[model samples]
Target: MGISDTSTGILKGLVVIAAVFIVLAGLKTATNILVPFLLSVFIAVICNPLIAKASEYKIPKALSVTLVIVLFLAIALSIAGLVGNSLNELSQQLPQYRTQLNEEFAWVTNKLAEYNIAISSAVLIEYFDPAAAMGLAADMLSGLGGVMANLFLIIITVVFMLFEASSLPKKLHYALDDPEMRLSQIDRFLQSVNHYLAIKTVVSIGTGVAVSLMLWVIGLDFFLLWGVLAFLLNYIPNIGSIIAAVPAMSLAILQLGPAAAGGIGLGYMVINTVMGNMIEPRFMGRGLGLSTLVVFLSLIFWGWLFGTVGMLLSVPLTMIIKIGLESSEEGRWFAIMLSSDDDVEKYHTAK
Candidate 1:
């Protein structure tokens, strides 16, 4: 009987794994449709608080939503303009930078040759094309454009979502048998998400501003562009800061010098370390914790599934899933496993 039970459990686990993969495959296939809707949901969540604050001032719901949408559009357009101007300037300067970079590469090759190491200029240029860095910057900008391509759809969806937000409680009450319990669970989940987003948004903005100021002080071109990139990529965890630094640092090397570039890199390292390690945790508190391994894995999984936008939304999307799991008695164990060690210990003691 024990052996039979063990075999059945193993089979059930395998089936569950297969089902999860199937679902993920479908999600990836439908990313074009899903990405816009998911983005709308996220926007609605962020704007909900503003809407509530507006209500306290006796503002009508439709008018409040209109105000928030207008604010969002203005910010979006300003950022786009900054990025566009940066890209245009960078493209014009690329040829001059490319010449300088080739000279630097030749100098490095000669220095290595003095040390009895033969490095071909062709090989070096092929492997490390200075023009390729600009190309990468352009590609990154293009990826942002792709995300904005669905802007109209996302805005429309967000408007409808905001409209439905006030009616969600009534809908839940009508749909669920145990309305109070489900409502409490949902409230907890949204509160946690809102808290996380608020703190993260503030931190990301600080990071962007800090990075921009540092670059500007160092006399780097496109300071605002890099700052905006930092703001967007900071939404991604683990490697996001590193990715944001690369283009700026590369530019620093070409425009300034190795010594100045090193300083710029050090500044980024300090800023990310101080903010990500010290400041964010104090503000985040205990409830929304996720394991480090899970964060990195989710980044890769979502990036693969939904491309760049997926990578940006990975943490929030994963947190939503984790919170949903925790809201269910049967699934709480899985959620606990995904949480930090401290959270896992707390869960054990509570149980």
Candidate 2:
């Protein structure tokens, strides 16, 4: 007798689940090698526009790639050196900072007691500890510093990728059957990714610069380090800005005072509000189209799988999977579940 349709569907579902489990296992085991390759791909995508611009000016492809790589390498090395030194100093000073934070907490508790507010210092601390924020900052930056260990490999990979990027469309054109349909899908996906990253990178740079200037003006230590941190974490969405702000605010509390810390916090709010809510929306239109829950869940999941690099590249990696799923009819429903309601509405509207 032929297999029942329900039985066949259940078997196919099990097969899909098994395949995902195997793929995730492989990715986790290969993270050390995969992380650098992924970072290279990200760098290559961001640098492609620079190469294209140079090519438009009649620059040779090899020379243009060389120039772009050299420029990026110089900048990357400078950031690594600066951030490394800053991290070492910060790590050494963390105990002192924590002590000072405790003193601040005690002082506040005493002041509150004088007013008969009756809040226990321990309870207050349990609910709010700025030092914890500093620890998070340290962890995030250290992860970035770790990536620099594989700098040579990543740069070389980026150089080759950038060189290949120009001719990739042509290569695919001849290689794929049904070039019209397949190429169109691939082209749309790449274009969407490129557009999103390019805009995000520009906004991140602006956020970093604005943050550095604000902290510098407020006389906070490690303004540049904090600025770079802001630039990197700004990619994470929702919580990224909050995470970036805390360490700077905590440092301000230690080095400057509560007033300066408050100023730094407010500055962060303003910068993120303008960049994320105003500027990005104007430039990006509807943003990445992924739901908020999806971004947050992916952040934790990818972070677990790939460590820091995974967290940093979570959105892009998820987008790649989502778009790939979207390209196949069988997976379109899953893609919709991953997307924002607005995107779902648009999908149905288009249908």
Best prediction by lDDT: 1
Please give the distance, in angstroms, between residue 157's alpha carbon in candidate 1 and its true position after superposition. Answer: 0.5
Q: Where in model 1 is the C-alpha error above 4 Å? A: 1-7, 109-118
- State the lDDT of candidate 2 residue by residue for 1-351, as single tens digits: 256988998999999999999999999999889999999998887888888898789989899888888888898888878888887887788778767767878898899889888877778667656557677887887787788889999998998898788789888889987777777877666677788888888999999999999988888888899999999898886788889998888788877778988988889999999999999877664647788799899999989998878887888888888987987898999999999888899899989
Residue runs of model 2 more than 4 Å from their true location after superposition: 1-3, 92-133
Model 1 weakest 10-residue run by lDDT:
128-137
What is candidate 1's TM-score against the reference?
0.93
Model 2 RMSD vs true structure: 3.3
lDDT for 196 (candidate 2): 81
Q: Using Cα atoms with residue i matched to residue i, what is each candidate's TM-score against the true structure?
A: 0.93, 0.86
